[model samples]
Target: MEETEQKVGMLGSGSWATAMIKMLGDNQKKKKVLWWIRKEEDLNYVRTYKHNPTYLSAVELRIEPKNLFTDARDVIRQSDIVVLNTPSAYLKAALHGVGAEDFKGKLVVTAIKGIIPDENLIVGSYLSKVYGIPAENIVVIGGPCHAEEVSSEKLSYLTIAAKDTVKAERVASLLRNRYINTVLSTDVYGVEYGAVLKNIYALAGGICHGLGFGDNFMSVLVSNAIREMETCLTAIDPEADRDINASAYLGDLLVTAYSQFSRNRTFGHMIGKGYTVQSAQLEMNMVAEGYYASACIHNIIQQYDLELPICNMVYQILYNKQSANLEVNNLASKLS
Candidate 1:
């Protein structure tokens, strides 16, 4: 198939998925971009209104009405490249009826930044192991980019990592625009794991903020968080040769830890401000990837016996019924 003739499909109807649609619509090549929205209401709304009514409503969609779909299998069958942008906790449900055969010979790109809950595997690894997709055919998208900023056309950077550089570059080409810059890498393991770990650190930052910790303390907390992230990523894939300070790793951490649009930070702030886990989740009305990640990472790290104090503190507060004030205060003592 010709490069320009290859069809691309987006799976998910959230803010990030909306942002990706906007990016692809802006691509000069103008390839067909198929979108799989989980809800019939959202699909009808986007087709009728040219915008996602619930998420990133302000970004006008340029998708052709014929390309929007409510069926996952139909979208998967029609597109040569499929981008999975759902929250990691809901990914299994999103692909409920999708089987290995549906993904055969297609390139799968993951924009999810959290680990698959019970499996404790990153998206790229999970897809390869469960769906029979080859590692070389999977691409992972990492961001210092937020959906809100992308919707507003603010400048942002993205890292596309895959075992195959050619595939990574091809995917990057589809997303690069005037406001979006792309960098390509071969460290799929490090990029995906870094994306997952950063959310946990962001939650820690939010908890500290809710507890009234100052900017001075935040600096130390994040510095240590990056080091902790490096420790964990290295343990997972020591041969990756990735730079922890790059946009995909440290930059992503900074944005999620401080951005007003960061749902994870918002969720953590709610928890720190005396709301119970149930109450915080109820009020946010969004999935804080870090909340699910806290437990998954806590479980994964046990096998490595790594010291991830920030992740541990978050897990305690959210899952173990520990006091946020007490847990964050104790965490402060350990930070250098």
Candidate 2:
């Protein structure tokens, strides 16, 4: 048996993808990683601008100009570690052409934080079922790291989760960068569940901001989000870490909840101010994962007949056409 060379490949070229490229580029053990962008136009734009100017303004991320692609299969075939950062709404469609049979012997990690609408499946769940990939083979990168902040060179932390503790450690070791730190978690489902649920809460936080509520009000919502996370996690896997109140969980909750850079938060703010979901998403020129996630999680909650107050309010605001302000106020009063 000879030493196997490790190569990294990432799918998607959004803000998160760009930031991830920079982080992976710092790996001395690995010289370069393959990044698959959706369009040649996006590849050209990043090659020239050195930043994803369309979304992340302050974070300057430039690739080697050679490590970009429009073809997904080509990149997938050549890399040993494939990191998926595509938005969840389009992830199924995105993987349509790529054959998972050829992807044997590769370590597939999910960098996406979303629950697929209607399907009500996390990216990891979808991959496991569709690709016959083991839960350990598909590590989920969860916790608090934000693409916007990473682009701006701000320090952040994240959790790498897999059923195999050793495999999770392998991802965590390769994932660390100057400003980014990653830890391994055995509770893969719990961590990913927290990551997905937090997106919905971030939208709620934005609605609170748009409704003219202060930090005090947002703090309550954030706490409520954690409670929701705990409930959802316990339903999926009891004995999951309860200390998610840490930086990775609550810390990520704060950034996505409050940051002007969060598309989900911004989308909610627009809805709170009277824009419809379609209009808000179009105006922002980005997919707010929370918008789709709120709907998806709501369906899951209803199917299980579970009570998720914050996510339910978000569903009412986006799907049921309820007033964001009124629903948030009602939710706040309930928690109060």
Candidate 3:
């Protein structure tokens, strides 16, 4: 592969995007990376405070005003590659205004994980079909990595998946650094699937806590989540990696399930504590993608007629009017 200069554009200015901006500075070459923020107020806030206080607190990042854009077409056209770090739920809507022509030549790497319920597609699948972008041009960055830990400078690793191994390597070259290690994978589907399903389990863990279940119960819930992930993903790709026991999977699940920082896990805890879905979502300031994903994935399973028992359980408790405690109790009793 030619060592060509590449300009990176970030689609959203959330915590992950800000942390990526910091990570990009470590690139050997001097590159102009643009981060798109829709709100003029957010632009001003970042400028004034020199930090993304709303999304990422304590870690201050200085962003250049010149690199911020509100115009999708302009940014997409200017960058060699675009890193889409927005929440999975907003991905399609965010790209609605931009035609395929804008993104035709650029390499797109996605850091967001969630299924589209209405479309019944993963991000890579949705982008390729909707935007006419080729699968070869789509790269998925996933693993058990968390943005909160990243902001704290904790060592983390991610898997980069693409149909073209060469392109995947290039993506690795661009992202790998002292703290972040990148592994290339041919199992794009499995990696992306695991990324989303783990969130469901993380929420389950949080719900256990919210229901006043202690560590022993939480451990069972977490273990069962990993088991569910392996079972479902292996059905899709038998050669798929089973390293979910690692930090990216189990570790991330624990943090999201238990940490005050995890909005999604916290959302589930609220629901388990008797907060209505609407109120629970409202109380959590950031996006709890699992809430939306639970609906979408549950629908996918039904449409495909695939039996995802744990995921279905989550959907029932969160949206199907099933009592959270009853669902847990029923599942626990059955396991015994």
Best by TM-score: 1
Measured with C-alpha atoms, the lDDT of residue 62 in candidate 3 is: 47
Which of candidates 2 and 3 is the stronger one according to lDDT?
2
TM-score of each: 0.98, 0.92, 0.91
lDDT of 2 by residue, 1-336 (tens): 654556788898777877787787664444457878787776788778766555565556645778777888888888878998988887776677887685788889998888877678888888877787776688888757777677767887888888888888777777687888887777778777777877888888877787888888888888778888777777767876657676656777777887878777888788878888888877986778887788777767877778788999999988889977789878977784
What is candidate 2's CA lDDT for residue 38? 83
lDDT of 1 by residue, 1-336 (tens): 654577999999999999999999887765789999988998999999999999999889999999989889999999999999998989999999999999999999999999888888889888989998999899999999999999999999999999889999889989999999999999998999898889989888888899898889989999999999999999988999699999999999999999999998898888878889899889886789998788878877898999999999999998989998899889889999
Off by over 4 Å in 2: 1-4, 45-66
Best of the two (1, 3) by lDDT: 1
Residue pairs with backbone atoms closer than 3 Å in model 3 (clashes)? 144-248
Q: 1 or 2: which has the higher lDDT? A: 1
Per-residue accuracy of model 3 over 155-265 as CA lDDT, tens digit each: 888788888889998777776778888777777887777777877877877777888889887777777777777777776668765576755556556666667777777
Clashing pairs in 2: 59-151
